[model samples]
Target: MTLILALDFGGTKLAAAVTQLGSREWLRYERRLSPIDGNATTDLAIMRSLIYSLLQDATPDAIGVSFGGPVDFTTGTVRLSHHVPGWENLPLKDLLEKEFAISAIVDNDANVAALGEHRFGAGEGYDSLFYITISTGVGGGWIINGQPWRGNAGMAGEIGHIVVNPAGPVCLCGKQGCVERLASGPYMAQDAKEYLFKPANQLQGQQLRSLVNDNLDLITGQIISQAATQGDELAIKILQSGAWALGVGIGNVANLINPQRFILGGSVTKAGEIWWNTVQKTARETALPEIDFEIVSAALGDDAPLWGAVALAESALISK
Candidate 1:
């Protein structure tokens, strides 16, 4: 039996799994939340623990890793992580290969997730699709012509940085109104916190305030969604705005690539019907009438990256 090891270095979590080659189910799996103040070293330690616990007495033929950052696919070097520090210019692939004494492949999480969806999840039967994750940060991946499309320098699917509202608040990337700035879960939470902190808006977010017991710092995208579901105007507005920004980005991407489907995943995608409706409505309005496409939820949910990692491992084995 050929064993395949897969790892996902997510912004907020770490997951590792071992499965038999060609199997759809994992033989062993483990996951843990990343420390709130964790950096690359801490994250790596946690992943190493999970990997050992999963592997036990067995050795895998190959390993695959999904990193939540920009990566040079050819070299498997991580450029940087927007949400985590100490990950800049890391030679992750080499480290993994050296540590395990086996072949290892690594890529950006978004790109790997796209391949995961294409091979085993939402985009399974589709020849072309775009997978977008709207969680801690917003990112996108492309499956073009039934294959992963990591454009020049492996930076092709950076839909999060696409300017949707150039006049909006500044993003960490020093850009105003980028899709991730407006649409990601953390940004949505930040916007809510900022809005409620204003004197004039104090009376506006009553429902939102109540959700967090009037503690503005406690506000999160999930809290905002809960508030929206309870009829909080401020929360609803923020959620809709994020949806709108993502929709605009999607529409533009559709115009440029015309993929058959768009698969949305991550925490923010669970903001309920209002968020989903706004995204659909805005995308339809933004796209030309001639463009036809469908937007759907990801089937693999948070496990997409892990599954994608398996695919990457399988590919590595095949190439060898």
Candidate 2:
């Protein structure tokens, strides 16, 4: 039986799985968290351990990799990672091929996840869609005419970097009011932390403080969601702000691409009805009346990248 290996170098975690050709289920799987201060060397060591554990005496016929950063798709070289250091211009595809003596395919995590959703999850049966993941960061992938479209430089689906509020807070990318600056988990937490200390906003964030036991450092996107559910004004405002930013970005994407659907995934998407409702309503309001689209959750959840890697590996086999 032909075997394919899939790997995900997610920012916070690493996952590896092996599956037989044409199988919908993994033959073996392994995953672990990346170290708090992990660089490419450490992350790679963890991934190699997982792969060794999963492969044992068996050899994979092909391999696919999903990296949580920009990648040169044609060369499978990782450009860089915002969260983890030491991953610049890493020749991942060549390394994998040399290590395993087989062909390997690699791409940015967002693009891989889009391929996953398009082939077997939310975007299945849809020829055109945008897959956005709002987690540690916000990113997007595209499907045009039933195929993944990685534009020149493999930077096409960068909705997170899209400017929404020019006067808003500056992002790590040095842009003010970019979608990721306002909507990503760390940014939301940072905003909440800063807002709570403002004297004029004293009346707000009471519930948020109570939830975190007055420890603002404990705030997170999920905590903000929980506080919002419990009627915390500050938390509600922050989440709504994030949702609004994402919604506006989505609206602009809709006007530009007019995709049939927008598939959202990642941790922030778990913020419940309020977040979802806000995004839906705001996007509708921001878009032109003529543009129509559906926003839905990704069906694969955390496993989308892994499954997408399978599709990528399969593509490599077909090309061979």
Candidate 3:
């Protein structure tokens, strides 16, 4: 069995994996990370060390990298990333190849995950699928015929920055009312904080004071989800509001692509059916009557990016 080394670079953590080139069997390795602080050289060195530590026994035939940012497919360079400071315009593919002395391929992390899911997970048997992640931010990827549909410049899956409410909230992208500002984890957290400050509402008064009196930093998206799980109406309302924004985003994608399935994944998705229900309701309401499909959860969970990197590497190896 051929072995492939896969690395997933994200804002909050780095995940490495060793797996059979064409199979799902693998060992997982993950490390929590602090912000990279825009030190490109240091960040690259750290990534190299982590890769060496994880795959010391055997040199992977090809190294697969899925980076959390826009990448120029023609140049194999990362354009920019909001979370990881030092990742901007980095030549990730060339760097990995030189560092590991092996073939390497790099692409958007979300795109890679969509590829992985299309081939081996919930998207199997479907000709096309849309993978959307609701987490620190909203992102999406498209897999067409089991392959990622990277646009001409390789910046295809940037649906997150789409303007939803022109006057809603300011996004890091210097845009107002992007989908992410209304639906992402931070947005949910911000919404929860605002909800806590509303005037003496019956549902928020006691809980809000309790949450505040304890010196809690502030209401978080997770806290709101926890409250919702405990049947708090206010929390449920927040969830619904976030979910509706997510649905509008999905609906826009759906009308444009009309994919066979829309796979929702990421950390915030842990809110479970509460999030799904609202997304479904809004998506259906906003969708064109002529098109229909399933809106479902991603099956690969958090490990999707790792597996995706492996899969992309394996495919690159085969094509070579």
lDDT of each: 0.94, 0.94, 0.78
User: Number of the top candidate by lDDT?
Assistant: 2
RMSD (CA, Å), candidate 3 to true, equals: 2.3
Better of 1 and 3 by lDDT: 1
Question: Model 3: clashing residue pairs?
Answer: none
lDDT digits (tens) for residues 1-320 of candidate 1: 99999999998889999999999999999999999999999999999999999999899999999999999999999999877899999999999999999999999999999999888999999999999999988899999988899999999999999999989999988999999998888899999998889888778988888878888999989999999999999899999999999999999998999999999999999999999999999999999999999999999999999999999999999999
Q: Give candidate 2's whole-model lDDT.
A: 0.94
Worst 10 residues of 1 by lDDT: 194-203
lDDT of 2 by residue, 109-148 (tens): 9999999999889999999999999999999999999999
Ranking by lDDT: 2, 1, 3
Better of 2 and 3 by TM-score: 2
| Per-prediction backbone clash count | 0, 0, 0
The list of candidate 2 runs beyond 4 A from truth reads: none
List of clashing residue pairs for candidate 1: none
Candidate 3 lDDT score relative to the true structure: 0.78
User: What lDDT does candidate 1 reach at residue 1?
Assistant: 96
- The TM-score values for the models, in the order shown, are 0.98, 0.98, 0.91
